[model samples]
Target: MKWYALLVVLMVGLGLQAQEEKDIVVKRTLHLMGSTFEISVVAPTEEIGYINIDEAVSEIKRIEALISSWDENSETSKINRNAGIQPVKVSRELFLLIERSKKISEITDGAFDISYASMDNIWKYDGTMDKMPTASDVKASIEKIGHQKIILDPDEQTVFLQKEGMRIGFGAIGKGYAADMAKELLISKGVKGGIVNASGDLTTWGTRETGEKWMVGITNPVEKNKIYSWLPVVESSVATSGNYEKYIVFKGEKYSHIIDPRTGYPTKGVTSVSIFSKRAELCDALATAVFIMGRDSGIHLINQLDGVEVVLVDGDNKIHKSAGIVFDTNQYVEK
Candidate 1:
């Protein structure tokens, strides 16, 4: 959810004419969940649109207020605070999102569980740990971690955690869901073409005003500010999860921040994972799931699910892609 500042630079080469572009790009940064959100939208400048961007921002805020686990007054926080005591009724949208997360958990065989929030924060990645946790520690931390224990009542739009301390939060899928909802809202408002770049989780509709597709650069996990691949995205969502973003060295071993729900321990051996799909929510959730599932199982899971593609960067810097991903190899040559 952290807003890594996005630098949108328009480069003009020498002798190039500055023809007026018909596209309009607007960016707004807002504070949410202890992080800054960078939202960008692109559309035709001449389109007769009545949709107000402020209203769209407000909608996003409402969704955040409903699902933020850190917010003590939020619905999700209430469910966590009252775990096993009651079934908290939530908005229909939140209820559906929880249902979808559970489905993903089933698909990944608990690799993408939302119940990991119930785990005790024993593994510190902030450079203070001396050694890895014992097997007993791992087991104890995940004692309350299980997706099967989460009960959902569709009719009542309620979620109940069967375990006393069980919890569910959308840290992995919230931004993507927000991006998808925003895109859908804008499309319903008759906005022709734009890209909703929610940090790295991006969803797009229609093409640029120049009739070309919106292009996205996949950053090289090993190299900063260098793109290893480029994807021309049109009406698709892309999301990436990587251990390279945050980690700590413990007893000469580096542990990532992305913890496995089943083990209550961070996953190793994988550097980064990227998923592309029709819905940003799916892409977002799957990217984290695949990162925890590692290379082989992750690739297999993605292949089984239709309309999903993945690009996995291994610890050795080798790239493995899913069957649905179609990219030019020439574009991925290691520099």
Candidate 2:
């Protein structure tokens, strides 16, 4: 054989060998970030897969420790503790997360606010709520709920809550951020394929054991054990926000337990909102924001954004989707 042809053959062999290294899949699930976190990694051997999964899990736990609002020593809690008093210096990692969160709040117009922690659970869904909160109390409940109140100092790497009683919680976007971070860690370590599912806010990279794209399904908001639609998700993130089970009925109006930070009231009109994006954190936040924005407004906002799609289930069980969300009729199931 010619020397050049031999070199080409050797290069192809080496490429195939590298591809063969990650031949098997290993998936592990555990309770983390206040929800079930599943990590799947494909490696040359089962042991390497386990190792990658462990490192990913550790990264997620570290993130949980940093931003957990319930932890008194967490950076987020520290910022809340000193609300209106002083700015609390935080790690650069935490600072960037808060800064991105603030930008999302700005884009969504406060529909997705971390400062929503000030909201009171006056609207319960566990068969206890009977009357609406007084207007004044409702106003007071959201007094400190404002994303603009969160001041971030990049130079100092500090976070400050403008109001004394204001607080921030990652319950809306923490898991997805954790998932994103975990995926990055695993990918950096040479894992050929993996998935980081934080509860239902999940992100996937590469293919499964069968070498096909990841397929995700949206749960039917109107029917149990049925799905509204399924889509192929490849190297992307998807998150859904809804009060399928938790809701209250007042004067023949159904209200979900997802409280709107702007109004300090339960979300209505839209039943469920699912968002697809490249960032898990963004998808998680947008799901909640779109639910609050309702059908038309939510679809409009999603259309304005790039590389994002949404599916909204309205009160009448009608499905509304964004421009890019072209459903495969074969995968679509009706109520």
Candidate 3:
């Protein structure tokens, strides 16, 4: 599971008129899709709020059934099973998701790839490895991993992998996509306000019960207990990728779990990457991509795109932001 870099800070007031039309914020935290999910919604009454949360949970489960590569019966698993032999027909929704993933792969210059699931587990950060894998083995680990090799048939809605061992997984963007879908479902039902936070990759729509925008606290990677800034989010998504939690130190150098599929090596020089975009899926993929791209190049790419912004923390624990991001200078606290 991805580290939780952004925390949803709920701001509720104590003084309120009893007769006023109050929108209650109801929230539930549960384990889903192998990660923690916090679903919140505003409703006219407590009873209705619970109902809406239940509906949102059901919608998330439905999406997991469709996209989870771990389930052997899922469409993604079928595509992986049929790799190199034949094309497997899938739902149009799955096909489109794969299509968008491939586009991101191209945009990031192969830094982000869904086929990274095909990589061999040569380097372990679980305290099992004392030395780095040989260069040849490291290179061979990514032999079957390439998003460019995934072939899609639009008319038939079929996906094929060029290599037999090739596979695809949505570990990076799946939760964000699920969060977006849940938020949209609530919106369609006329729910005015809510937040679907899939372990830090979160989306918000409408206002809080107090009519204020949702506040997302960006945690300091160096000091996890402290927040560096508060971002007001309205009808937008945010995702953060950080390597401070799980990593291995080899020869006094740190290697994180997030690997670069292109080079089959762990990325360096960046501690955390947070991307803000209109869609959670985009933010999710770009968060991982930009982390692998390093600080300067990541900022350069984010500046080129419209409706996108980035805030990154370099290895020295310094904060960097894109052209559009504005944060209070005094709020930044480094190690």
Candidate 4:
């Protein structure tokens, strides 16, 4: 072969390699964990990107099967069915999750309780809250709600609820947990960059398809359709818990859906709580905790935690951010 001919061939091969290295983002969305889970990946080829995305969706489905309380045959159901009778053996993953949930309950001073599943939905949001219930009835609403009653046996890998009617649910944190696991699975499968956004409980790693950081918009809780601020996530997670649309009005007062497990009363004065953390699980749980804690106490508790930041929307539609919070002003446009 001629020298110039070989040189020309080498240059063409190098150019093709460079083209492959360029960012190509492929995304897919599916309904999982009772929410829309959007998986995005930046890969060299569409085939590779979709392969990893399907893997993530499978992992999420596996998780949902393990922990969904609604599933009559799931381990969670077994545990709930055997409540106050015997400890039901569960997977190590579920055991560890229960431990983490208990820790979160302790950190939030009972503001975050997994036993919230036992609470009766006395405060209806279907415009049926015309009259406030008696104080005693409201107090009785959460009589069975308490996180301290959940006993975890590490040696046996079992979970026990002390009361027969008591139950635990992951409605607040399950989606975020699924998002974190999916992100980890994708990363291990060589997904260079992407996001696992499970209905706003988002966990992101690496850059977007444009080689820029992932930016998330915080919606105005009072004005659900409006985006008031933005946050940039490099290799972290952000979760937003809002009560704008899920609220009830009683006696000329509005109450949010985030009911206090410590008390049966709904959370008042706070519209939404957005949390940023290294794990979506923590962010998801904390967002719920902060909403129940009210504005001042929630801020105080979050300020004490490390690697956690919160943005609160007050009932008046005012935005309040913690000390560690800094809005991404580049995307913020003043109207």
Best by TM-score: 3
Pick the lDDT winner.
3
- lDDT of prediction 2: 0.79
Q: What is the lDDT of residue 267 in candidate 2?
A: 75
List model 2 lDDT by residue over 1-335, tens digit each.
00000000000011122344347767788998767776777677878889898999899999999999888888888898899999999999889988999999999999999888877666666687789889888888899999889988888888899889888998888888999999998888878777787766888888775576677766555564455566877899888876666777779887777888998877778767778899999998998898888899889999999999998888887888999998765654432
Clashes of each: 0, 0, 0, 0
lDDT (Cα, tens digit) per residue for candidate 4, span 1-335: 00000000000011122233675777788999777777888788889888989999999999999889999999999999998899999999999998999999999999999899998777877776677778899888788788888998899999999998888999878888999999999888878888887877888898766566776666644544455565678799888777756777767777777788998888888767788889999998998899888889999998999899888887787888888987654553322
Runs of candidate 1 with Cα error greater than 4 angstroms are 1-21, 43-52, 220-225, 331-335
Compared with the true structure, all predictions reach lDDT values of: 0.75, 0.79, 0.86, 0.79
**Error of model 3, residue 155, in angstroms:** 1.4
Give candidate 3's whole-model lDDT. Answer: 0.86
- The global Cα lDDT (0 to 1) of model 4 is 0.79
The digit string of per-residue lDDT tens for model 3 on 1-335 reads: 36544433333332222325776777889899999888888789889988998889999998999999889999999999999999999998899999999999998999899999999999887789998899999999999999989999998889999999899999888988999999888999999988888887888899777777787666665666666677777799888898867899988988888899999999999888888988888999999999999998899999999999998989898888999988863675432
Q: Model 1, residue 311: what's the lDDT?
A: 85
lDDT (10s digit) by residue, model 1, range 185-275? 8878777666665666778888655556676666665664556666777788788787755788767777878888987888898888888
Question: Considering only N, C-alpha and C atoms within 3 Å, which residue pairs clash in candidate 4?
Answer: none
